[model samples]
Target: MARDRKPVKSKGGRPSREQAAEINGRILSAATTLFLKRGVDGTSLEAIAAAAQIGKPTLYARYPDKSALFAAVIRAQVDAAMPPITGVAETATPAARLRQVGRAVIEGAMKPVPLGLMRLYIAEAPRHGALIREVDRLGRQAALEAIAGALAGAGGADAIDRAHVVAAHFLDMVFVPHQMRALLGDVPDEADPLHPTLDARIETAIAAFKTMHLLPAE
Candidate 1:
């Protein structure tokens, strides 16, 4: 009887690419909900799997562990929230493109999910130095390059310093201040960080660039 035992077959249907993507999406949504509700340290893999309605084995099959899963969630959050600036080069003028990029940056910063992830990352930065560095290298540095390229296009080959300045100012004006506020829980739910009033900040940045002759007068 033991010798006649049949080979066990794999259970369930094979997951198609679409199905896998759907599962990944569910996992991310569940992880995001838990991360926001309980903070990174407070949340657990079991909870995520439960929230996603998937078994622990399935969750681990998709993501090896919590750190990998957290990184995936952060990467997804950043990618979805931040629109790539590649197309900005197509604009007729540098100032126009810069302004567009600036607006995009502001909008991305103010988005709720990205803001939450940003807060989470900052909170975890001290203990999770490697993860923080990975995020900066993967997300922030890449975005900075795009901004620098746009600035270079606007300011010309001679304006490298100006480009860097503009890039730094752009980040500070749009993200840093609001991010700090988010970290402090000072941002009201209904407050719009991308409101027209925020245009003053953009205008000030533009003016600073203009003072250095990096941009033409509007």
Candidate 2:
């Protein structure tokens, strides 16, 4: 007797670029929520996959491991919070650029996810020294370069020193206080309590940087 042939199953439609982006967005959203709720150590790949409603293999395909995913999320948050430095000009004066950069930094730090990630980084520092060092190295390099560029463009030959001081002081004023409060679980119920107001903080930081001789005299 001849055996009956089974019908062939059709392959699923290929995901387009937009579809892929949507998937990535879902994964990132899930990761952000999970990371914030559970901390890095408590979160797992399976949990992320389940939360995102995708298979574990899909998550791995996009990010090889948990650390990579976490890093991507942090970078995304930072990019969103900070404005790009495209319009900065060599003729804008060092103080102007410094103010712009300072504003971006303050805005970036005050973002909810970024702030949460910063807290996580600090808490994990004791055990994950390498991760902390990596983050610091990248962050410091970006800040130093931007500050140095602004100072050099506006402050002439003394730009390097001035940039260093500005970078340090800006971080101290714009980020350190709020960062400490968040780390200590002292963030107020109000939205953006860490930053309070961006314009005010930026103005305050610029003033301080000028007072410290980190910016060219007007």
Task: Point to the candidate with the largest lDDT.
Answer: 1
Task: List runs of model 2 lying over 4 Å from the truth.
Answer: 1-22, 75-81, 86-93, 154-165, 182-213
Candidate 2 residue lDDT tens string, 49-123: 888877877788899999889877866654454545556777777768777776666556666777777777778
Q: What residue runs in model 1 are displaced by over 4 Å at the alpha carbon?
A: 1-13, 84-92, 146-165, 185-197
> Over the full model, what C-alpha lDDT does candidate 2 score relative to the true structure?
0.70
What is the per-residue lDDT of model 1 for residues 72-185, given as tens digits with 9 covering 90 to 100? 998787677767676765545667777787777667767777777887888888877897778766766656666767767755567766666677777776556655665576
TM-score, every prediction: 0.75, 0.66
The all-Cα superposition gives candidate 2 an RMSD in Å to the true structure of: 7.6
Q: What TM value does model 1 have? A: 0.75
